[model samples]
Target: MGTTPLTPGLAPSPGSDGTGVVEMYAGDRASQALGIVVEDFGEDWARCSMTVGPDMANGHGITHGGYLFLFADTTFAMACNTEGSVTVASGGDITFLRPSHVGDALTAEGRAVATTGRSGVYDITVRRGDEVIAVYRGRSRTLPARPAPPAAG
Candidate 1:
């Protein structure tokens, strides 16, 4: 899981149907439970949003760091998986710069910074309005192809 420079000219293009990238994120239940919504994504970029409700706040009445990380991680996942490959985060780091209170609507934007072979690096910024609240960096690796889920009953 060492950091590798993103290979040039290797960034995948948007899916042919345009909606395939979005469909990949629709199956994420944990993000949904946290009120995360995928706003837009294409190629190596993704944008997602979440509202800071009571349940997301810590004892100090500010949004928990874990929640912020989760939001950014979800955005990173969407950005890296746009190519239709099953990707997983190998590791990530986040820096908190500001506090978010209840009712604040936070948006995370992620972009692929580098990629080589089966590994990639992404950077995500969490913002409230125009103010940046946190910055996140994630490393991802594409996994071996697995069988798709069985058709819905």
Candidate 2:
């Protein structure tokens, strides 16, 4: 997984159909299936958003914890990978500040708080409007480039 870092303040802004970093988001089936959109990104930061759907609700009639985690995780992925490196989350944890219901639109903004070598710490805030819904922290590691496939015999 390799890609060129996106130029700052470029076009094809999120919610569109493309991204600058190797179009990784374009190939991301999970985010796509969840209707998560990379709304914007720069260098080591990214903003993503999605609307809560009925399917995302738990039996309690509120959004499931897993969905919030996934949304934040996806935003974390976008933030870390902005450097064009093949980054993967080593681990992550979330703290829910409030519960959201279906039909509520939520946004997650992620910033790389610190980066030394291949390791980085990211902080993400998930919000519904001006109200904070959750906060997430993620650790990421950039994977080494994969070896080329064997040549044709």
Which candidate should be chosen as best, given lDDT against the real structure?
2
Worst 10 residues of 2 by lDDT: 1-10
Worst 10 residues of 1 by lDDT: 1-10
Model 1's alpha-carbon lDDT is 0.81
C-alpha RMSD of each candidate structure in angstroms: 9.0, 5.8
Pairs of residues at least 3 apart in sequence or in different chains that clash in candidate 2: none
**TM-score of candidate 2 versus the correct structure, residues matched by position:** 0.84
lDDT of 1 by residue, 39-144 (tens): 7677878888888879888999999999999999998988888767778899999999999999998999999899999999999999999999999999999998
Predicted candidate 2 versus true structure: per-residue lDDT over 1-153, tens digit per residue: 122133334454434333434467767877778888777777788888888989999999999999999999999998887755689989999999999999999999998899998899999999999999999999999998889999999
For candidate 1, the per-residue lDDT at 56 reads 82
TM-score, cand. 1: 0.82
